[model samples]
Target: MNPILQARNDMLGQMEQMRELSAAPIRPAAQIDGAVAEAGVGNAFEDALRAVDAQQHQASAAMAAVDSGQSDDLAGAMIESQKASVSFSALLQVRNKLSSAFDEIMSMPL
Candidate 1:
């Protein structure tokens, strides 16, 4: 196969791994489980938002590093940044669709 395509595939694989790592369910760490009975919606939403923000920040930083000649692997950085962009865009779409569904639901007759 072509080198660029192979590289892209590798980058995609890495992104998948990172996503899995990030989204792994909280295994109820012993102490926290004992302390809190239920995880609140606000906290979970906040955490998810924070994770996406962090990914965006990291992607930006990586791109900057590549631009400034501070990094060696241009392909890797570009791939990561692209992955971040795709992930954020997907998230935005999902949010929009959810909002639309919610609005539709609210408009339904009782």
Candidate 2:
């Protein structure tokens, strides 16, 4: 198997673990009065969008660096750009689904 393919699989496994950890319950510190529950649905979506925005910014910077010849390999930049594009596309789809849900709810008879 190619080294890149192996590395990609490893990264994906790690990301899955991270996602699982994020979904798990957390115990609040003594300083905090009560347990803050895992993020609400809306907050979770907002946070995901913010993370994607940050990734998009980083990818843009990396692409710029490659364009200016500041970076040696173009592959890394290309990968980052693709990641950003995929993330943005996913976010757009989520937004569209949410909007459709909202419209459906509004159309329901009371």
Candidate 3:
């Protein structure tokens, strides 16, 4: 097996594991006696934002460690940085789509 292909597979598996771990259980609004559910859309969005922020912080810390000569894993630091950058970009894209959708709905003639 090619090393690059093996690495790609490993990364994909890790991502899948992360997705499963982060999967929040959904509860119908009625199940909570009118209390707001933690898995509500707004809460989900907030959670995603928090996760992205944490990723950014982790990447920053990894880079700092490398810079300070405390860690020799430059490649790992770079990968972390890239992951943070990609996640941030994804979050921004989602926000832009949501904003556009809101604007479109507001302009609809009732």
lDDT of 1 by residue, 1-110 (tens): 55368877887999999999789776665555667555765576567677788888988898899899998767767777877888788778767877898899999999
Question: Which of candidates 2 and 3 is the stronger one according to lDDT?
Answer: 3
- Weakest 10 consecutive residues of candidate 2 by summed lDDT: 27-36
List the candidate 3 regions with Cα displacement exceeding 4 Å: 1-36
Q: Give me the overall lDDT of model 2.
A: 0.84
User: What TM-score number comes out for model 3?
Assistant: 0.70
C-alpha local distance difference test of each model: 0.78, 0.84, 0.87
Tens-digit per-residue lDDT, 1-110, candidate 2 = 55367649989999999999789877465435566556566987989899999999999999899889998657777777888999999999998999999999999999
Candidate 2 collision pairs = none
Give the per-residue Cα lDDT of candidate 1 at 10.
88
Give the Å shift of residue 61 in candidate 1: 0.7
TM-score for all predictions?
A: 0.62, 0.72, 0.70
Q: List the residue pairs that clash in candidate 1.
A: none
Q: Highest TM-score among the candidates is held by which one?
A: 2
Q: On a 0 to 1 TM-score scale, where does candidate 2 land against the true structure?
A: 0.72
Off by over 4 Å in 2: 1-34
Q: Please, what are the lDDT tens digits per residue for candidate 3 over residues 1-110? A: 55356658998999998898569576666664687555666787899999999999999999999999998877778878998999999999999998999899999999
